[model samples]
Target: MRQRLTPVPADLTGTVVTPGDRRYAGLRSTYTTRGTPEAVLLPRTTAEVAAALGYAREQGRPVAVRSGGHGLSGSSTNDGGLVIDLSALNRVEVLDRATRLVRVEAGARWAQVAAALAPYGLAISSGDHGNVGVGGLATGGGVGWLVRSYGLTVDHVRAVKVVLADGTVVRADADREPELFWAVRGAGAGVGIVVAFEIEATEVRNVGVAQIAVAARPDGSTLRRWAEVLRESPRELSTAAMLLPYGSSTVLSITAVVAAESLRRVRPLVAPLREIGDLLDDRVDLVPYPALVPTAHLHPNVGQQPNLTTNGLLAGMDGGDAAAIMRAARGRHRALVQLRSVGGAVNDVPPEETAYPHRHQETLVVASVFPPHGPGALDAAWRGLADRVDGAYVNFESRADARTFGRAYPGPTGERVAAAWRRYDPDGLFRAPGRLPDLTASRG
Candidate 1:
């Protein structure tokens, strides 16, 4: 028998979509998991968001909050529950061109945000993919194309407008509601529904981009040289590398983004990278900053990409650590491994200033497994790398287990994050499943 959903509230009469509704098909799932929610509430304003939250609470169902529905863990959608979809509330406006302070709605994709700010010669350092939601990336750590120069997207957040579990709307910043503001920067999933963010944009009209592919040796010497070039290079250059199977061996494919506007300056910075190994391919171009994350990447999420992903932070990739990464990519399971240069402007921020405290790490390593493989396969491929990694990033992780949370938060950061979550949301309404155990007891 089909479950009967409660009648939609008068305020949400036109906004609610049920199973039989034609719109329900598009709103039913995330990027990684398919969901069958009883109803999906599409709110266009902050007041409507508050109403939607109240309606979900009255239904007595597990509630999931979705911004752009691109979350890797699939926590944005639930099997049989209510989903507060915020895609309609997307709006980007420049409050002050002098200060480069821009207000962005949570529902907006990074592509839309970049397009909106292009006219004003302003841009936020969002993720590489244009389809990623602004809320998810900004709240968590944003390791983007200009990350080494401008830092994480969360680092530029000036304030946030959030709707709490009790349907109370509040604005948090450095001077007001400081604790809530701090928690929202990195560990926001457990606190409340953030409707919008006020972020400081950078002045960037054009950037130099280089796409290079080189032959990678099995012993990890090539990998070490790649890291060495990034560490010694100026803060203006940031790169993302992927280890891929090339014929009988693996090749390292890299996309290097330099913050300079002219090719004259970009060539010298990336010259060292080409000399690392036998170059398979190399290309450089000076394109508009918006081109890096173009609107062409935008698409609806209907569980199109299904993969299990995990990541770790490295203070520095030594020969042993580098070999472990290569081995994981070439192992029996053949997990896909990717690396991002971190530790430029990212490390300039003190660890205690925000919820994201992995400030000392120099590189971000991510590994993923697709179909025909499960958690065991992923674990087996990652076993050799488990000890070498110093920390983990919450956004890339597919599991919401206690162990994953510990690695993401670690030591005093975890304790403080737990206390803040409890203070703001005592009933645990927004907590991810199995994410918040008894941390004090676990530590003991």
Candidate 2:
């Protein structure tokens, strides 16, 4: 039930939007969908966020937090609850030019960060989608154009400013609040609201964009060979294979980015992929490191399209797995299958070092169908390749399977994340949608 809107806090610096408010509709909308949130509080400061959390607790209303509102699971919006919109907190500051230390507010998008850092010839490894929120992506393992070169976004995180469930603000990092720091890196949705991220940006001038189009079918051998080629490729080269649906046929399109200073140096590394199938188009060009992320590809304006997605982390794809994936693609009238190459710098970090435990996985596979087609076929296809599936990336994840969550943060990492949840958010105010209860919350 929607709660009655109380008088706005006079001392609150940000805007409190409720039902019937002029901006309510716009504020309640996220990337994938919209929600009927009772109240949307746009907080400009950490203190305002804490106040809003306290207000939500006082009103006995569920709380949801939104940065760029790109969460695939729609965790940023809740029905008849308080949505703490952090869009006003967008700010990016370069702390150190020498070390490339930068402080980015949680609400700041990757495009804003890229634009801010480009003048300095500095860039943080982030998702290819420029409009993707810095907070959500960084927290849930960012696999971007530079995955092979710099590693996941969490790898470069120096620190984080988090607002606890009890409205307490704390700074977490390797030394300060180390446990919380570890949890915030990956299993971030369940814990608390992150206010800012202190990232160690890397220096890069230019990157090479590699694109190859091949007319393909569900032969299984084609995709298997593509995976093999990527596995042996140089660290500078990172690639993603997309199964694009055209009428009744599906085309296998491979796109790669070489995070090298020049295209001449990366040609040998990415040359073998051209012979994978009947090549239709091949283009390799040099551009600014930030320019590599195409705005059109992000699909920021996903209006009414019902996007059903499933993701899995794969160690290696055999012919059987590839065949299953192809069959799944062919079965669906429209299936968006994306397999991102993630091994070099991403796997370098040990699973135990952070909450993101799938370090040994070679590729991140995400399959989606818009407008809600045969949804069962998607899951069935994923199940066929279940043996090679170790874990799932939280950013691309929409399912709430206990086994999948267990795989995502396995062993001690799971235990530690639960511990952090209990320690900071005992009330379970920020529990992810369809997720199990936090340890302490369950006990209570």
Candidate 3:
């Protein structure tokens, strides 16, 4: 039996692969094993993106956009719909060397951006790994090695070029389309596809890197103390502490970065961390800003595992919360609880200033359970911890329901974002995975 081919959009400048195509399997693969879309549209230019969106609107099919394809929630891929793949638009350019202003295409990876700006001694505070796409992280509020020192990637965004749901191309910034600019910073996926971004970079020299293994305390006194130190530590240092199960006893793997040119400045910033637990292993050195990205840690297995993850932002943790976290970490095998210190310059930005409203958060906690494993227990454990925190970082959230989305963008902030969704995408042609409320209908 012959199957009828789905017609590709006539104006699409890039490739389109359907279900029966040989390349479909490879094109549809992502960081998590998500459902295959009916067609994958790879658009290279902004006009082509508009054409694809117009076509998706005409077909009345759900539209999902893919960048680096490393989204843990698998929102970038879907079944029986259109997946806009932006891999062909990966270009990083230095717009101004003096101000360290850089322009990055949506499809570009943080690593490529890093490598491009390294020669000029410029860097953008991005996700921990280099392979993470600029579009997803920048829009959703980036938390990275330089978070404490420089703030989120979205903080540095000077402007953005977005294709709204109606296939209209618009430039958003503080002075132009200001409301859309605010919405795109944190709740981008809900409104439109960001084709490119102009980011203001920070000048830097060699930065300090520390990878340490410390013995974990079951009662979580160490975890509490670690949090205290990070709260009091200098903004120059940012750290991510991971609690992993290690036969009979748990281990805390600490990765810290200090944005400094000398070992003298780095040593004092890391001294408090050294006092955490029995230091099982320690490695501290200075590396170029780009080298700070831990590429090896980004999706080490690719799309093999069904990645289950939960995220929360804590203003401060008490003894009860620490004990709860330790208990959760011990529940699942190969489960990891990552707590990143996040309140330096990040807190300097007022909650109302940007779409990201978590400026009050002291720490960002991420609980991940990897594959070759069981089921509901992982989610159950993560949910228990989520109850303790104020909110969740959108990038780290795994659940794709309206409830989870509400958690990610909550209260008045959520309402504003929904209003933006209504204003920019009244018809809702751009379909995000979650069951977002019908704000447009409500407006009617």
Best of the candidates, TM-score: 1
Expressed as tens digits, the lDDT of each residue in 1-444 for candidate 3 is 423334765676337778788878766767775566788888889998888877767666677788887777777777777788887788999999988889999998888888888888888989888878888888889998989999988888999999998888999999999999999888887788999999999988689988888888988888888888888988998998899777888998999899889988888888888788888888889998878664444442236657778788888879878887888888745467898989999999989878898898888988887765534756677656757888888888766666666788788887888889888987776544452445555432
- Model 2 residue pairs with clashes: none
| Candidate 1, 1-444: lDDT as tens digits | 545677877887789988999989999999888888888999999999999989888877788999888888888898788899999989999999999999999999999999999999999998999999988888888999999999989899999999998999999999999999999999887778899999999999999999999999999999999999999999999999999998779999999999998999999999999999999999999998889889998888899988899999999979999999999999988899999999999999998888999999989999999988888989988998999999898888998777888999988888888887787777777764633443433443
Runs of candidate 3 exceeding 4 Å displacement? 1-6, 20-22, 294-302, 332-334, 372-375, 432-444
Model 1 gets an lDDT of: 0.90
Q: Model-by-model lDDT, in order?
A: 0.90, 0.79, 0.81
Error of 2 at 55 (Å): 1.3
Per-residue lDDT tens digits for candidate 2, residues 30-51, read 7776688888888888989888
Ranking by lDDT: 1, 3, 2
lDDT of 1 at 82: 89
- Residue 275 of candidate 3: its Cα lDDT? 87
Q: What is the lDDT of residue 315 in candidate 1?
A: 93
Top candidate by lDDT: 1
**Displacement of the residue 21 alpha carbon in candidate 3, Å:** 4.2
Question: How much lDDT does candidate 3 score?
Answer: 0.81
TM-score of predicted structure 1:
0.97
> Model 2, 92: alpha-carbon shift in Å?
0.8
- For each candidate in turn, the TM-score is 0.97, 0.94, 0.94
